[model samples]
Target chain A: DTAVSQTPKYLVTQMGNDKSIKCEQNLGHDTMYWYKQDSKKFLKIMFSYNNKELIINETVPNRFSPKSPDKAHLNLHINSLELGDSAVYFCASSPTQRGNTGELFFGEGSRLTVL
Target chain B: DQQVKQNSPSLSVQEGRISILNCDYTNSMFDYFLWYKKYPAEGPTFLISISSIKDKNEDGRFTVFLNKSAKHLSLHIVPSQPGDSAVYFCAFGNEKLTFGTGTRLTIIP
Candidate 1:
């Protein structure tokens, strides 16, 4: 079984269009994260949720919002998407402890392209 | 600013040679370090990790060495095979994980 999965593996939309990517993990993990990989292959963390509580919110733009309905799901919604927003978005999950040393299990990323 | 930095963008190694990938971090607060391998059209998978208290950790052909004083870490793959060719990312785990720009390793047969 796929440990982690995301919907719409490929997304192509015009500039200013809004889109949403859904993610789910079956790893029974307590923490989930959203990371963006740019054209340069630089991966940066965007948001994180631990047991449905927002934990880490990076310096991402306001147009990006993350919602975790439950511990197994974390979805990202982008508004007013721009050309610079074109990149690969990855969803990952990890077991959370008081001092977490766990590794992340990532889903097949969702590629977003803005024209 | 990028806290974790992998200076080499790409590396090529022979099938039976040792591959050394280096990483540097500026955050002294980072206590745990990890290496993740990514293939095309796929998300990264965790490879190996090292703690600030330990200088080296090894698993099979993969070994990770951490130098807290220098704030540097390296992943050494012995007898690198073609299947090992992938993008390797160095990451630091604190409240969250921060990744470095990946290094693409190409194993030549």
Candidate 2:
């Protein structure tokens, strides 16, 4: 089974349009996160969900929203996508083991392009 | 602000030599640090990690050294192989793992 997966591996849309990226993890992890990698290859955390509860939310723009209907899935929706949104979005997950050092297993990443 | 940072954008090392990658973090609350390797068109893979209590951890040819006081960590690949060429990312783990800008490593055969 694929540990982490994302949908729409490549997305290209015009500016001011709306789009969504879906992600799912079969690892049964309690925690999931979203990260953005820019053209410079700098990865930055956007949001994190733990058991359906939002945990960490970086100072991202208001147009971006994350929805986790269940522990196995987390989806990102972008409204009025701008050219700045053209980058790779990655989804990762980790098991809920406190005091245990857990590693984030990332998905292949969804590449979004806004023209 | 970038919490975790890899100063070198790229590094080249010959096969059969040691390749060292350095990372620095400013957050003292980070209790765990990790190294990830990524190839183009693929997700980053967990390489090695170390906790705050341990200063060093080794797995096969990869070794990670952590200095808490200096907030520094290094990944050393001994006898680097040609297949070891990839982008290395260092992360500082808190509620979420903050990644660095990544360092592209090339191994010359």
Candidate 3:
């Protein structure tokens, strides 16, 4: 069984279109995060949620929004996507900060291509 | 500004040799650093990590050495095998985690 899973492994959409990527983790972790890996291969943190509370939001465009329905799920929704938004999005989960090893269990990234 | 930087985009090493991948960071406040490995079409996996209080951490054939004064850290894989070929990323954790662009390590037979 996959620890962390994201839907729509590959997506190709037109600019200005709206899309959402759903992520779920069965690891019983308290913290979940979204990360973007651009063309340069740099992994940038977009947002983080701990037990359904928003935390660690980076400076990203307002078009990108993250929703956490529970501690085991975090979903990313993009409105009016642009070409610059084409990248691989990764969903990760980890144990809470205290007594944690800082190890992030990541999902096989969802690749988004905006044309 | 890129806080974490992996200057070498790619590196090639002969099999059974030591493969060293380097990373540098501008932030001295990062409390912990980690090395992650990734293969094509896969998410990066945690390889090893070291804390700001320690200079080195080793696990099996993989070792991570951190030099806080120089703001640099490196991952060394001794006697590298073909399966060890992958893109390596170094990340620093403070309030949040910041990652470098990553260095692709190629092990040639």
TM-score: model 3 vs. ground truth? 0.97
lDDT by residue for model 1 (A47-115), tens? 999999998888899999999999999999999999999999999999883487758899999999999
Q: Which 10 consecutive positions of candidate 2 chain B have the poorest summed lDDT?
A: B91-100
What's the lDDT for residue B69 in model 2? 90
Residue lDDT tens for model 3, A73-93: 999999999999999999999
Cα error of candidate 2 at position A61, Å: 1.6
Evaluate candidate 2 and give its CAPRI docking class based on DockQ: medium
TM-scores for the candidates: 0.97, 0.97, 0.97
lDDT of 3 at B27: 86
lDDT by residue (tens digit), candidate 1, B10-93: 999999999999999998987789999999999999999998899999999999999998999999999899999999999997
Where model 3 places Cα greater than 4 Å from the true spot, the runs are none
lDDT of 3 by residue, B1-109 (tens): 9999999999999999999999999989877899999999999999898988999999999999999889899999998999999999999885467999999999999
Cα deviation of B55 in candidate 2 (Å)? 0.8
The TM-scores of chain A alone, one per candidate, are: 0.97, 0.96, 0.97
CA error at residue A101 for candidate 1, angstroms = 1.1
DockQ, ranked from best to worst: 1, 2, 3
> What are the clashing pairs of model 1?
none
Error of 3 at B88 (Å): 0.1
